[model samples]
Target: MTNDRGTSSRRIFAGIAGGFLVSTVMTTPASAQDDPQHGLADIIVTAQRTEGRLQDTPVSVALLSGEELATRGISDPAALQGSLPAVQFQPVGDVLANIRGIGTFNLQPGADAAIAYNVDDIYIAHATGLTPVFFDLARIEALRGPQGTLYGRNTNAGAINIITNRPRLGRLSAAAQVQAGNYDLIATEAMLNLPLGETVAVRISGATQKHDGYMRDGHNDADIYAGRIRLLFAPDQGTELLLTGEYSNQSGLGAGGSSPCLATFAVAGCNRKGWDAYAGNETPVPDDFRSVENIGINGQLAHDFTWATLTAIASWRRVDYASLTTTGDANIPFGDFGYKPSNANQLFTGEVRLNSLASSPVQWVVGAYYSREKMTNRIDRTFLSDTLLGVSEVLDRYRATSRALFGQVTVPLGSRIRLTGGLRFTDEEKSASGVATNYFVVPAASIATGGAESHSGLTWKAGIEADLARASLAYASVSTGFKSGGVNQTPAGFGIPSSYAPERITAYQAGVKNRFLDNKLQVNAEVFYYRYTGFQELLNIFAPGYLAFYTVNSQKARVYGGEIEVVAMPSPDDRFEASLALLDTRFTRFDLTSFGGADYSGNELRNAPPVTANVAYQHRFRLGSAGELTPRIETVISDKYYTDAINSVAGQQASYTQTSASLRYLSANGGWSLTGWVRNLENEAVIYSYFGGRGYPLAPRTYGVTLRFETR
Candidate 1:
């Protein structure tokens, strides 16, 4: 079946490729070129912990401006999968983000994500903190591959840096936007900036969105409210301080679960392909809902000296999340059961660093970092009947602490070549305790367990970059990444291991960046290889009369991939951009002793599609003495991929394409605008996870209109 799908995918892309070719030929002319006033704009990034042009950064990075996000109707990180290369997002109980085929699958508090999500240079220890801070942002940077030195542990896959708009010392401005759409959608956003004195300023922003469910049973809905405030103080030329506070609340029915067919592919909707409108055998439980609340505060201080600059950062965040979902298993005695999970997580982090002046011949930075995370997790199981019947419950508490010292240096070898090296030493410790109770038993028996462990490691990176031309760069690098080990809070009588070993990865990569046609065309390409060891995998063991969950280390794996991105502005009125990623990943040796000693070796990793591509085109029509009209079309393509490590037939999400289109009109002064947009034109419903022979789908087709206003 996989082979047949591969052939079918090839045929589909052939047609798409032809269509793109003809469109380009019809819209672009040989005489058309970028005018002196317009071309590809420069993108500034801080991928290396310093501000620089994106083209000059040695790391592989993808940057998206806040304006672009708003225009595309992207309100959260989970929506980034279709628009970015080598990235995927799935929102289960908590958000799961993957980059380059590496991510977290375990939901335990003791487990850490391979990909790190950061806001304003402060890392978010948990994924729940990442869902609500997508508004009023300067830009978002997706750095691919291991961020070993600059970002210490839990960055085996890479990092996402979300830079928010800061306070302006001498500006007073305001902006507001509102949107209305089908499915009873309504969204509003506002921003205000005020200058308090000659050296003090403040910026405040807020957003709220509410929409009805998109499912036939009204299971998928949205309700979100978020706000942020920034305060800046710069009393002198050499010293600066910035403080930020944020809060968010999200509550609704959340995402629904729908399957095209039951496992074995012989049930209701068996003949369906994509997007069955809640017609599966599974039924939604009453009062199914999800909620998350987050609060965060952080501060940054910097002092510049003659030879170098010293900086300090401190942050604290608290996240409370809960969800109630149905198991959707018809085989159960009474009916589908309800699964409710809740968590209260808190994190505290601090860092101190110093960086050499930009004018120095050799640039360097040294830093020390510390972080502590604590969480209380609980899960309850109940029968979904008129009278709820308690079945089972589990309660756990986890704590983790980490400390690191890191440094990086860049030395000029010649006029056009530079050498770079970095090292980081990390120490981490984790402890967990839990109690499990079974109410189904006559007397409701219970068991308790607890343990602690510590681990340490050293990770490093080395690279060299050279200027190929005035506007081009070529570079190569190798880096190592680490994730801390964790304890399993299960009864010792189960004979399960007390702890699991840490996971590691070594990555080698090379890339080239280039600009041509007088900055009218930009192209970037990269290839990478990774050697992964001690892959951490969560396992379920069914003992004589009880079930236990624990994490284990798989043998090894190999991952190789390549990506290419192109942006062309043949003329000021026309723009075209495309990106493609090719990935090959396999578990070289994976033997699951608990699951009847089955071997999943030679299987492809979950969510790692062999081929993925995104293409977008837009054109502007200028109206003299009036506003301008712009229309845009975009498509995202993906090859077939699995949703679980076992790679079962029911877990395979077939190859598909999702398309979206939008039209916008802007006034001559650019202070006001209106946009009409539609996403998933064909209503492609791709499943993100599979459970109890059922598949949970993503968003469906939707249309909306947005109006924006700003004061200068």
Candidate 2:
């Protein structure tokens, strides 16, 4: 039910954006501080962990730089969807991010992840530990709404910060790259920055990737490996320390194994089958694969004492995953295979912070947090059948603990208004134990019917700000968030309910942050509203002879959204960007009596989508000494969404428009570079769905070439 990304690649990207916008003409805008091009380049965000200046942070953030992720060739994180604005990325097998419509499509282990992924600030409770291949980066921030006063708990659908690239004491940089495209694509990356004088410094990074997958058979494929190490320490004027270690390993072929399509003309709603083809069904899983291993460590410390400034952060993580599939009858594929789903997780986190220096107008902060988690799940559908029909065999074990205490403040009503407040208090506990067999696997019992449960909460935020000039700012906020409640690894003949609760949100926001003319143009806008009381959903109850997975509770819901971001540099060689998002998710009350008694009130909320937009353009050329050339184009648009939540018929995802392009070259003064890229380019038919529509296909027109080197 997905097709359409054609029209000769939109007339070849509108004839290469109309011959480069009529021979480009512009200047100034590089976050202009006396002209680094004259504007748009002053982004310093800690998203409230301190440091501000992203148009004065009124939250509606979306900053991605690392040279704009290698001039738009974006590496990973599910390709970051529209890069912002309603941000929705669902590549399952761990990678389901939804902002503004909330997210989480049950990854099991009692499910928990309503957006809240961090890197440099720790906190990354699985998602396969992010970045399947985004290299040494230095920025990526997207904060939408309900961040619960400086990020706490699951964040209620907001917060994503990944800041890499640290370790520079005296500075001695180096970099490397290599890539080749089309199906047999290969990638390699390297980085080193070592300096041991005046107080240590060291950094090392690595990446490797392989590809061959576009599914239509030929069994999807890809393998990846990653590594990182960083350490920095300085003990003078005001102490500093940082340490990190990371790892990643993945084996693919999984994402595409779950493909099932049959909607040549169904007739439901939300574009049920936008085009035609394949109404027969029969792709019976065969080469479905998955493997992931992750490891991590992080430690950071800082001290300033000029009046006060002390911080500490620590984290440790581990994840392991395995997969295999064939949910039976695709027209009979070897009769319902088994031993697929698997997981193993371990995580730990710690935080401590305090600040108060610069007296006078008053400003403050305080923090404390702790976390501990452990999970183990393995479901094997004990198989054996030619008519033998044997089932059962499951195992689940979970444990969780969290503690929190937070604070915030800011006061000054005179010189441009300002007043903010924050609070956080949390204490959580979860427990589970299981075992179920007998289908020839013996031992059938103990699924922990209902055991351990504890939840405590208080999440808050109150805001008011005004600057209106000197870069601009205007904000208003009210927030609350938290998501914690566990058990429910289902499957043990689906007796359901190990436990479930703790899902809450209350958000209301207003924003405006601008930087005009002299600054080359930067605008940010936001409007949000959310109130979900116990909306923790993950339903698929079709019992008449099997298949049940639950984690319900949807008493009330309503999510409002509005987002806008625009950046323009008119000069300094041209750059333009735009974004927009408008959403209105529903479900005023959902009552699913295990499937028959369905009262899904307003419906519409699975992967929520009301509208989305995008635009981008780039220009810069100066081949004088045979160096420097840049050309780019981008476009993304979507509308018509329903991935499920009582909206069946293979849950639609119709409306589509996607395009990408690039050309880069730099030398003279820079250590060498080259790039040529093309992605999707309208060869689009990208569908990555599951839950009764089963489709996973992304990658349709790929082109590549990259070679780079650097040193400083």
Candidate 3:
């Protein structure tokens, strides 16, 4: 890290420290029982596959409840960047999440994401399905660092768990909400719960949204519809069953790109354009409309025994989508790079586990997991010029299978210490077959290619925790992570490798959780370091008269980071929260053997900002015999970062800050509420991603109002 960047990180941390010191010295101790509204509320989580308090879990994780999600208007993972420490997002038609500088480097089919995403304990195999599962959720947990032992494969970065609200045994309740905003935006959501019998209950929920484009010519809009149904059956106190079904459809003038010249230094050959302008060469540029449809069904059964509990889970899901998008040469006119791709995927998963009862002195869990996925896809390409015209079509089929066995045990030592250990063994296999035909060639040419690959590995974790005080705990752990390799679908005779190697990581982490001022103030801090090997890197080869995509393994790399979070509730009406994260990453040894042995060692990893911070404050006022009003303000700051492995000037994003505010009013009976909100008050055109010469900017200034009602 540079001296300037280091100094900037220190200054941010200093500000957070200042606030903590003031809250500690100025506030008087008060019992939470007497002043219930002045202290933080309890948050329950299932990070370790069981119910537990957030502060008691021995890991670095963040949680956001359903109420928080609705209040902040956060319906997808892309909107969770600054709300959590050591987290970031990049949207390239499909949303991708990054934690602690590790994320997906390959966007091709059959490639797995570093961050594992799960909905109600069921793994989601594809990125296109992540958005729809966020609705009607109870809470979402983001675990930072490696979570390979319990989560199994493809969790080198971390994991996200989305827990939904289940049916109540005997209750009748309903809620509805409507929102209207600028850009002709409108959204509606509703939910209902009903009891069928003494042992059966059902819940249903749906949401729909539409909005105009953010582009200058009204492109890049959003249209989404989703619904879910859950049924719960409890035969007796020892046995329970739950079934879930979901469907969603998303269609719009999807993601559009702008010229990078608008965000970087002006160059002689660059074409400067506005952030909202589309960067393309086609005359009367066509809208990049895309659509996705998904369906899923899952079931869970559990039985409690005298000594242990047995649980089983099974799920099936399908996703279909189509898109038309511009490729490289986004800034050059008359470029021949565009394509339309259509795909369908089907997946099935099953798991069985057993764990000791909560009263057991030595808590233990054992589980086995299995998953299979099949995909079919077709791509149509067009390359036209003054001298020649070429059109090509490729049809491909792919399949993947995975199996795992995992176990974890925790034992108490003495009176204030505990030891934990875990292990998981995973086996994965992938195969692909494809045929390509080119029409504009001399007499037309056709080629075929197919290959298969398999990988197996063992991942483990061990940790120790100690209670320093009644309201404080300290813990440390070392863990390993794994992501399987896969085959490429490119045709033969192109010198493209058929497959890539698996990537692995060893992470060392330590943290402390503490509450002060009579439990009204909380402060948590953690630091982590990773030794990464066989890093998979996706390469896009663009040359004269040729275009190719491939993946290769980088020899080695290193990543290190730290985070601090503070929350203070000085009084019943005032609240404050702040967080800061610092990161440093580097590729220790990497060589581009396919590109004439070009060495790229010592380069910083892409999207790994050296400094990031968030700060927020809120205050509530009581209206005598009427209602209550609350207002909030927040700001997020990020340092300059690169969007490509090469770190080109065109892919660099400068430091920027964004601010948002909201005012909410609630009825005296707590049955209805209204909120007015505004985001990005400065209308800053902050670049989030770069594709060749094309740049994608974050949303500009937006304002809206929401009205909600419910039965209490």
Candidate 4:
């Protein structure tokens, strides 16, 4: 452990820090020759405001349907990385997100995720808000590239849209599933749908999961519960309405970290632990269990008229998250680094859109959006010796309000080409106030930091699509995205410029979608380039003997990438799919005034892997007198990636591959089934992230069996 004391006043600090930070399907059609085999199903998506065929959409999107999730056991957001190219969710504390090298690394108060999350067209306000649990889902879509023209702020990267199953007025159904796995893992899920009278229907669903920690050190365990209720009404021929309420709760032991290199990142009295032998030998034992609670209500209404169709959506959500975990060395007087944090956020959003109903050369969609969010955060940093830093408290409160109007129109040029354009004007206001207290300060009163700021901008998109031979399309587009700036609560007192600058991105992309071999095989490919200004990052600074968390800004960055997706249905019983993501990222310019004479130009962005690929194959066979049997296998491979802005090997996740397999058996009626699965089949301790010199290795090999029942 190196113990050289450095000046604490410098703005840039990366010597050490805390927690970790930042898929699907298809369907198309069948040609004449494909009649002998099961055709790839036609998929419908709402990537644009209106429902349309997936392959015909101009944008790039990935889809995973309800059946896929049920088969793969992907019930949470963290499990989504392996199934989707160029998408990631890792590093615990902050649950960071990165899509095509665009994501937020700093998770200070008021900082929003670059990749936004939306449920049924209603936006989720904060990055750490409810990552909607997957149960009774219709489908999940990841819209890649800039979507600011329609989705609004915080979508500089892209957006994730989740749609749940809607109630059926004339159907009654029930379903249930149970799973048990290694590490004492147990999970249960159930759903019910009922019809009332002739005009109404209701649906209810619930899920719960519990698991023992994989490590003897007693970390990385999970306990979760979630439920939802929905009601649908169609009182007349032209009017429809749906109401929904949902809740999610989580309790678990947080992730553990290990120092890859004992000298560079570890402090005195800290023995580096490897991925195989994780230990809390010097950590704060009996650490407070991390927990999260989320509650939400959503409503949707639609009416048809002679001129257009009007759709209105309203939503409200409240989220509370708390965590306590180990961070740094136990020996350094002020370096124990274990801290406690709490965050509570409340959000309300409303949107209304009108779509042209009449057939015309120009079809259009226009909408208005409004949202407000209130957030409060409290961080209590612990020091082994209070005399070293003299302080350990932070309380912050922030509010953000936004309003926007957007419209898009499309015109078909004859039969071969279509031209489309869209624009949005957004106005946002933000205010924050916080207090920091330390023993170094003479006065008994705490230091005050907070202020008011506002930002507004116009983001737009333009694209052209050309129909090619054999149900294929080629598209090109250019778009711009926006993310508002925010204030920071720091121990540097109130004198420093306590807020960061906003971020802006301009992206250009081109892609091709094709279906060949009698529509039995599908291929989609895209290439994109991005220019970024005012990138935000968190700096862990140690001034003399004291430390504080601060949000910093960088000048500019450049990122370019491409992805390819392929799906093949060779026969009615066999399927093969693969996806690959290639990214090249660099900071074009990075020189901060506060960090004395340091340059980070040419460093790769954190959490952006240069290369990643996934492959999977499944085969089904008929069993005499029994039913059907399926065997499936998958693998994910990735190149090395960094976890910090400085790009140190000490904070990097080395390249590795993960393999998984499953075997399933189903009854003749398809109403009941049994599945056995195993993940990380190789049992390789692949590290994906790091925090406070501790590495977060991927979970070891896990095998489980699942039984499911359903009725119609």
Estimate, for each residue in 1-712, the C-alpha lDDT of model 4 and write its tens digit: 0112113201111111100000112323335565434757678988887888888888889888987777776666666657777787664543556888788766476777888788777888665565435688899888899898878888888988888888889899999999888889888889999999789999999988888866555666778889999999999888999999999888876544343233344431122344333444344357657888999999999998878899999999999988876544563434676567788889999999999874655779999999999988887665655454455555566899999999998888988789989999999988888887665445634667677779888999999998775467788999998777887777453234577777888999988787777877888878788999988777665555456776666789888767878898988888999887777778899876454535787788888877788899999999867889999999999876776787765666666788888889999888999999888887766555554555566567888888899993
For residues 1-712, write the lDDT of model 2, one tens digit per residue.
Answer: 1234224333433433332232121211323453544556677888877776777766887778776676566667766675666777776666678887787877566467887888888888757777577888888897877687667988788888889899888888889888888878798888898999978898999888887665544334568889899998887858889998989888865443444554545563223544321111244445556888898888899898877889899888888887765544342233454446777888889999887875537888888989888877766543435544344434456788888998988888899889989899998898877764344333433333335678887888988988755666777888888787676655445545556787888888877766667777766666677988888887755443234456767888888756666788988878898776767777888876563557887787876666677888888897778778988888788765667777665556666877888898888777878888886688766554535545554546777888878884
C-alpha RMSD by candidate, in order: 4.4, 24.3, 3.3, 7.0
Name the 10 consecutive residues with the lowest summed lDDT in model 2: 19-28
Query: Which residue pairs clash within candidate 3?
Result: none
Candidate 3 residue 275 Cα shift, in angstroms, is 5.4
Give the alpha-carbon lDDT of every model.
0.79, 0.71, 0.78, 0.75
> How many clashes in candidate 3?
0
Q: What is the lDDT of residue 455 in candidate 3?
A: 85
- Candidate with maximal lDDT: 1
Off by over 4 Å in 1: 1-37, 131-133, 256-260, 265-283, 328-335, 383-396, 491-495, 539-549, 594-597
**TM-score versus the correct structure, for each prediction:** 0.92, 0.33, 0.93, 0.91
Per-residue accuracy of model 1 over 1-712 as CA lDDT, tens digit each: 2667546545544544444333333322222453446888788998988788898898889888988878877766656657777888776645577887888877565678888888999999778886553678898899999998999898988998999999998999988988888889898899999999999999999998888876655566778899999999999999999999999998886664454445544422222454364543355556778899999999999999999999999999999989876655464335565667788999999999999997898989999999999988887766544455553445467889999999999999989899999999999998888877756556777877667879887899999998877667888999999877787756666567778878899999888777677778877878788999988776655444344567777789888777778899999899999987777778899986663546888888888887889999999999966989999999989887887777777667877898989899989888998998888888877777654456667677888988889885
**Residue 317 displacement in candidate 1 (angstroms):** 0.5
Q: Residues 1-712, candidate 3, lDDT per residue (tens digit)?
A: 5678768766755654454444334433344453445587767888888877787788888778887777766665555656676787666667777888888856577788889989998889767876542567798899888999988888888888888889998899999988889889788889999999899999999888787766654445678889999999999999999999999898876655444353355541122334442433333246466899999999999999999999999999999989876544435434645667788989999999998998898889999999999998777665556655444445467999999999999899987899999999998999988876666567777778568889887899999997776667788899998887887766666666788888899999888777777777888877778998988777765544445567777889999777888888998788999888888788898877664445778777888888888899999899977999999999889888876777666667777788888899989998999988888887777666665566676666778888888889
